[model samples]
Target: MNASEANFDGIVGPTHNYGGLSEGNLASTRNEGQASSPRQAALEGFAKMKSLADRGLIQGVMPPQERPFLPQLRAMGFTGSDSEVLQSAAREAPRFLKLVSSSSHMWAANAAMVSPSADTADGRVHFTPANLLTTPHRGIEGPQTQRALSRIFADESRFAVHDTLPMQPMFADEGAANHVRLCEAHGDAGVELLVWGREGLGAYEGRFPARQTLESCEAIVRRHGLSARRTVLAQQARQAIEAGAFHNDVVCVGTRQALFYHEQAFEQTARVQDAVRDAADGLFDPVFVEVPASAVSLNDAITSYLFNSQLLEIPGEDRLVLLAPEETRENAATRAYCEALIASNGPIGAVEFADVRQSMRNGGGPACLRLRVVLTDAEHAAVLPSCLMSDELYARLCQWAETHYRDRLDPADLADPQLMTEAHTALDALTGILGLGGDFYAFQRV
Candidate 1:
């Protein structure tokens, strides 16, 4: 198999899924006498647009609504219109989807390569719109991701692509134990690679310790062996703000952190020069150069702090778009971010910033919205200390785990720790899945 087929590792990320969903409700609930800030006003405006869209006033311009979700919106006292305003809004709106339930948000994968799964008997992948988002979510189970997975692993020669869905229910900090259970299962399966990181925390229902997450990852790595670089522990650059190293922000190749602080962008260039001396690991890429052309502002610094970090690889050309934004407004930031991408001179694909905007509405940017799942070459590479003994052992484990755990731990069971545990116990059936001799974490639904 070619590199693409052997390792179909790609960045398929979503924007942070915060604030946008309830902006309309938030705007309507407030007293008319209350004052609002520009950020609040912008949110209110966005809320209004979404509100108008919901009432059919903005129709195609807004995200596609689900039949069941509509009643919930109406019950919430959101009475609007179904007039012709929708056509106008739709016309003026961007062609891409926004932060909505159905049609509004989008999912994108890195464009570097598309691969096929080697484990499959046949080497073909196909997808339809219906199954696209079906992989997983907090409440909804859309088929979009399923379709993507299907297409990615259509044939045996393809690298099996899987969707890493966030364990739902929303929590600022802890996540349901079930989500952790799912992580265990996917890792042991040795087929489906899961993505995760600090960004994934926002999507989970409850909060858990970062150590808990790291430990969980350690569990997977110990059992199945990590396939790709999967960790959320890096520090990214920001102009003046103290870096958010707690969230795994790290300096990456294309971007740079300011060595010295200055109001003027030109003065900042000198710091970039000073910092370049320690350029050991591809750290001096253009994105990291704190050039004088644009000094990172407070908000811009925050934007950069959350995004353009070591965890993600934004092309230099596309990187400029995010770096050039002056206004921190959600809409403006989204516009500039997308524009930079559209204007890129690289081989990147289309990125509808609406999805990102919607994600931000929830709380995180693009980087905060994804998880990392490393794909390794050995099934049991983490064990055995070498790759040779893993192949036979891994195959044996797969068969045992499949028959024993398949019935108990369905994907939906990832929500229940009880069930997840049951699933994990059965995982020994597939010892061949990995060569690792360490203890395994199974998927027992709670």
Candidate 2:
């Protein structure tokens, strides 16, 4: 029952633009109202998947959700046909239209929380889509994410897809962005580390909103039936949150038994490490690779998204590789830190930079654009073949993006009825490409 982790990355949608709907994301806020190239964005995302697949790592794809989310507009009392709804919303409430038309789902790390078969009680891979209740634009993603996950991981005996937790502020879940698992091997029973920003009912006076709640983490643990002895819950540093580390992943990431993070990633850093070590007592000794604040300040780390890189166990590599965003390479401090880190003979043997500037502009890095699901051979075989990446699939996806996606899209373009039509048409064809049924989207449902 040897297992390996698969990264399912969300395809950048046709409506990709800088909406700046995310409050605490500095990049998103900074790049607000800028024109975006949907064609380039989608292609860049595909290149990342192709690169990983070329390295013999399993790469999967998740289709983007339907944008302009017409149903939401209709629910908000915007009457008439789809085109009319777009026009009316544009004329009356332009800001609301931009929020609903956001393509932020391209960051799939917030798609769901997954537990490998070795860790779950039933010996099955489990998924619970995040409610994403912190932001209105992202909150609309739960239903579609649930549908997509259920469809891709449809086999009953091998996988279990649970409904999202109650969509309440009390149960504000941001999925894997605030979660990590450390293990000796991909197949081994791992210690799950769930990070929380604030208590559900507690007040936080931080400059930014605290997304993941302690109660939400507990709920997922209960739903997945994870062993209490093998779980560790830690609070995200308040300083880090206010510093624009909106999600814990912004300041930390873990793979296998190595936890690479910033110094201020957690409130009680030593205790969190001790708890993780205790949970992993007999299994494996956890490696803590802490990047001191002096070496790479919290602002530098967040700005460069150095910690948001993916730590991977490549096939031939003895040590893990850090797949970071191009921003890390561009930033002087993070670049020096990476050079020092790889040369130090540590668990991270190599550092690779990926050009995901389109996503980066919207505050997502290499790690944010993916959802990791560890699966045994049997569970892997059970996944929908079309959802997995192949050379042929990549080619087809590239052609699809070039043919369907716009070369450029601006905030003003969101008001055009044409953009909505183009989005629906592209997504409709994409359903066939991904083997998602025709009724996969809200517009297609009718």
Candidate 3:
């Protein structure tokens, strides 16, 4: 049976703004107080999805969660109407309000870790929404993420959606952004690479926090019933973390048999390679493309997001293509390296840049914007039809964003009670667009 990889990109939410919530993410912190263009941001994301779909690739859309998460505010003992609650929170605790209103969910790569039916023991796709316990803003996304995933992959006979791990420091999981799967083809049994930032409750002496834990990786593997023989665990380099490579995907990405990564990406690079070779023994010969620090320093890689790219094995193409961010081309060092790479006649034959500067400013790039899920024809068909990207959907989404999103949003704008109304109204309309039903949002359930 042949299967293909689908990129399910989260649509940029209506409340897109800069709050500097992620402590370890340098870009987010650096651009904290800057105003954002929510309308342009959403349009850029939609354009990227449409481009991929036009290129004969499978692209899907994940609608954003309702913003100004009033339920969470109400839970915090803020008693009043929705507008009054917003006013009270703004007057009393603006930081808490910003945390709940964050549009970080646009980065779908951190949404979940997916195991294709080809790799799972039960022959069904499995999804485990990340606990994201390292940050208060992201930690609140699990419940909504689970609900959204469940709605999209509703066929229990073909898809198994599991609950998130317990929310504890010992089980901090950051989803597919910290995971990679490599094989000869999408349908083949693959080698699963589970990357962790630290061991359970262990001390990390780096300047930045290590989000993924070793115990969480093991728990996900066990819950997904992955083959132990084909699973390899590796720790992320503390140095990379200190340099602001918050997720493994920031410094590494894999597709088919090729792994493109910065040399400093793993603590024990040789051991990781050897384990991968052993696991992929009869399956496929792993191709490792290591970029030395001398060529492109860790700082340059993080700034340009060179490795935070979607490495795609496009249909009818003999070699892979790197869907990189436009920032990679703008940076002198990374640009020169990309030119040399294309001329080197390597497995990665071409490098294309996407203009997702809105997302790039906040520490997410092309890879960060989407979650990759490999599915066979039947499994693909099992997915909700409206959720899949199409020419019609793209046009509709563009118009929808123009109609609902604000042209410019300052951090202070979050305090306005009308913004909350606008966000909920947009989300309510989006549920209809995605066919997710009226009660998809918490407000609707109430």
The C-alpha TM-scores of every prediction are: 0.30, 0.99, 0.99
**Which digits, one per residue and each the tens of the lDDT, describe model 3 over residues 1-446?**
79999999999999999989998899999999899999999999999999999888999998897888988889899998999999999999999999989999999999999999999999999999999999998999999999999999999999999999999889999999999999998999999999999998667666889999999999999999999999999999999999999999999999999999999999989999999999999999999999999999999999999999999987777789999999999999999999988888779999999999999889999999999999899999999999999999999999999999999999999999889889988998999999999999988888
Better of 1 and 3 by TM-score: 3
Query: Residue 301 in model 1: shift from native, Å?
Result: 2.6
RMSD of each: 19.0, 0.7, 0.7
**Tens digit of lDDT per residue, candidate 2, span 1-446?**
59999999999988899988899999999999999999999999999999999999999999999998989999899999889998999999988898898888999999999999899999988899999989999999999999999999999898899999998888999999999999999999999999999999888777899999999999999999899999999999999999999999999999998999999999989999999999999999999999999999999999999988998999999999999999999999999999999999779999999999999999999999999999898888999999999999999999999998999997899998888888989999999999999899988979
Against the true structure, candidate 2 reaches a TM-score of: 0.99
Cα-based lDDT at residue 34, candidate 3: 96
For 1-446, candidate 1 gives per-residue lDDT tens digits of 22111111111111111212322122112222222121231232233223223322211111111211222233434344422222222334311111121212222211111211121233322111111121112123233334333332333232333332233312111111101111111212112221123232343222222211322333333332333332111212222223221122211112122121223212134443333332322322222222221433334434433232212123333222232111233434434544454465532233323232332332333333222222233321221232121334324433443344322112122223343233334333222243322232211111
Off by over 4 Å in 3: none
The lDDT for every candidate, in the order shown, is 0.25, 0.94, 0.94
For model 3, where is the 10-residue window of minimal lDDT?
199-208
Pick by TM-score: 1 or 2, better one: 2
